[model samples]
Target: MIRVVLAEDQAMVRGAFAQLLDLQPDVTVVATAGDGDEALAAVAEHRPDVLLTDIEMPGRTGLDVAQELQGEQTRVLIITTFARSGYLRRAMDAGVAGYVLKDAPIAELVSALRRVHAGERVVAPELAMAAWDSADPLTPRERELLQEVTTGASNADIAVRLNLAEGTVRNYLSTAMAKLGARNRSEAANTARERGWL
Candidate 1:
């Protein structure tokens, strides 16, 4: 049997995936997690063959988990609603075995999981092509500042949370806005998110 660890923030989605995946004769839902941290814990405990997760969730994002698990035995497969090429590119860089949209049919998702387990890369054709169109321009610090900007947090607040100077936060935001060709902080955040940079 193919052991699987399904991770999604939404309880209903997690339960549904668990139930549906469990019904597959060749697959077993070894564990289900509601957040990235829990998903990592589950993977460590179960040593599943696949980690199927959404991009965004509480704690670390799925991309973060994938980055941490690179070179491990378990394969990572992202199942998310975000179709932005930037996210896909980041997933590929993190060594994720597959990237499948949440709207894909369950059968296709299962196929992707199996393929990923078999060491084959899987991604939507268009997305795989688009992922190379333009690389993400912002650095990690810039991305973090922009993410906080989207939350409507002040530079001072973000500074305190990130343990950076308020001036540093402002500078990062400015750099991110310039790189994204955004007119303002809000616009910068929106542009980054639209491009899946944030």
Candidate 2:
């Protein structure tokens, strides 16, 4: 049997996935977790063959878990509502076995999981194409600043949060805006978001 651990923040979704996978003849739901930390612990405890997780959760992201477990025994499969190019690119960079949208048919999800368990790469075609079409232009620090800006934080607020000088925050914003060809920080944020770069 293919022992699997499922992790998602939504209780209903987690239970539904577990029930469906458990009914499969060749797949077994060995464990379930509500967040990344719990999922990691469950993996350590069960040492399952596959991990199916959501991209965003309260504790940590599926990307974070995949990066930590890459090259390990358990293969990672990301099942997320987000189909953004940035998320797809990051997942591929982390070497996840599969990345599929939550809106995909149940049959597709099951097939992808089986494929991932068999050591095959599975990615949604549209998301892969989007990843190829768009690229993340911001540096790590610039991305960080943009994330802060998206939260409606001002330069002073961001400076205090990042512990950088207000001038430095403004510079980072300016550089990011220039790179994105945006007229202002809001425009930069919108551009980055549309390209899934944020």
Candidate 3:
């Protein structure tokens, strides 16, 4: 069987996918996780052939986990609601093998998983053309800061959480705001998120 680790935040979606994959004669969901951190743990423990994940989750994004798992045995296949081309580019840069939308048919998703396991790249046709529209301007640190900014956290609170100095946090946020053409931290965070950079 093609062992898979399924990662999605929504319990219903996770359960449904696990059930569906289990029904496939050639596929088996070896484990399921409700968030990115949990997904990482499951993948580390199971060493599955593929990791099927959603883009946005509670802890790390799928791209983050995929980036962390680069050169490892597990191939990652992203299934996300966000259709932004920036996300596709990021996933490609992170070395994920497949990028498919959540609305895609189940057969396509399964096929994509198989293709990824076979060491083939799989990206939705609609998203493939726009993947090079422009590179994401923010660095990984900027992305993390912007994510914290979206939580409406004060710079001091963010600094405390991220273990960075408050001045450093402010500087990073300011830089990100300028790059995104956002007038403020919240706007910057929202813009980055809208573009699937965060």
> Measured by TM-score, how close is model 2 to the native structure?
0.89
Q: What does the lDDT come to for candidate 3?
A: 0.92
Cα lDDT tens digits for candidate 2, 80-198: 88879998888888889999999998889999999999989999998888888888888989989998989999999999999999999999999999999999999998888766666
User: Highest lDDT among the candidates is held by which one?
Assistant: 3
Q: Can you give the lDDT of residue 148 in candidate 1?
A: 90
The digit string of per-residue lDDT tens for model 3 on 68-177 reads: 99999999999998889889988988999999998988999999988998999999998887676667899999999998988889999999999999999999999998
Please give the CA lDDT of all the candidate structures: 0.91, 0.91, 0.92
Candidate 1 lDDT by residue in tens digits, 1-198 = 899999999999999989998988999998999999999999999999999999999999999999999999999999999889889988988999999988889999999988998889999776887786878888988988888988899989999999999998888888888888889999999999998887
| Candidate that would win on TM-score | 2
List candidate 3 stretches off by more than 4 Å.
Answer: 139-141, 155-175
What is residue 130's positional error in candidate 2, in angstroms?
Answer: 1.1
Where does candidate 2 clash, by residue pair?
Answer: none
